[model samples]
Target: MTDIFNKIETSFRASLRGEESTDKLIYVWGIISYVLAFLLNKLIKTVHVYFFGTTISAVLICYFAWHIYALKKCSPKKPKLTKEEKQKLREEKRKEFGKKLMRKLLLQESFTKWDPIFISIVIDAFCIAQFIDYIIR
Candidate 1:
């Protein structure tokens, strides 16, 4: 039990530092958080409870924003490559891009962090919008 908590805390701290969460834990966390948010919306039937949705939205927005910032900041600066190396790199990139495009269009697989983060942002925005709608009603 203690080990589990410690590992979770460590992963959280690593993510806060802009590093990826330990292995598969982040996917688990995101799924659990989404389910929890959905349950909260369903079980809590009052307008005041909308605040919970808004709060979750804000937290998620901040987290992904910081995560993106950290990822960009921590990315390695590429050293200048020889022309041949540059050509090889460009060729590799093109191949990778083609693979990704095919995977996205055919297999519906998203391997990049940005895709999930973008989806989360859209959902969070919807949560916020729902909260505002409730308040307005």
Candidate 2:
């Protein structure tokens, strides 16, 4: 209804401003994209193979450009570190990586970040749709 649409619009605006988590939006979009792709394919009676490819490429380019822009705009300059300090930092990162890997393996960690999940959902939907179409034909 109006309430649902208002929430979606708010979320979309917030996401555009990098002020909101996009997990729900990405999930909803993934489902809608897949459904629409199927319906469009059926209605048109022909697949536009380049359409999705071009769309994905353009999205990726824009995403990377925006990411670079954000990083350049918001990131602090790195401090110059002494050799010993650099080594210590690297050792700490190594230990942290090891612990993180172990935690992930044991399922003690949960990912709340949305980007990887969003990308996987998109790729999976595309692949699954292509597979289903292949089977139907």
- Give Cα-based local distance difference scores for all models: 0.59, 0.55
* lDDT tens per residue, model 2, 1-137: 99999997786566556565444444564446556655754543455566554554444444434433333333334699999999999999998998888888888996444554446445554545564454444
Best by TM-score: 1
Each model's total of backbone clashes: 0, 0
Candidate 2 RMSD to the correct structure: 8.4
Candidate 1 yields a Cα-based lDDT of 0.59
How far off is model 1, as Cα RMSD?
A: 6.1
Model 1 residue 58 CA deviation in Å: 7.7
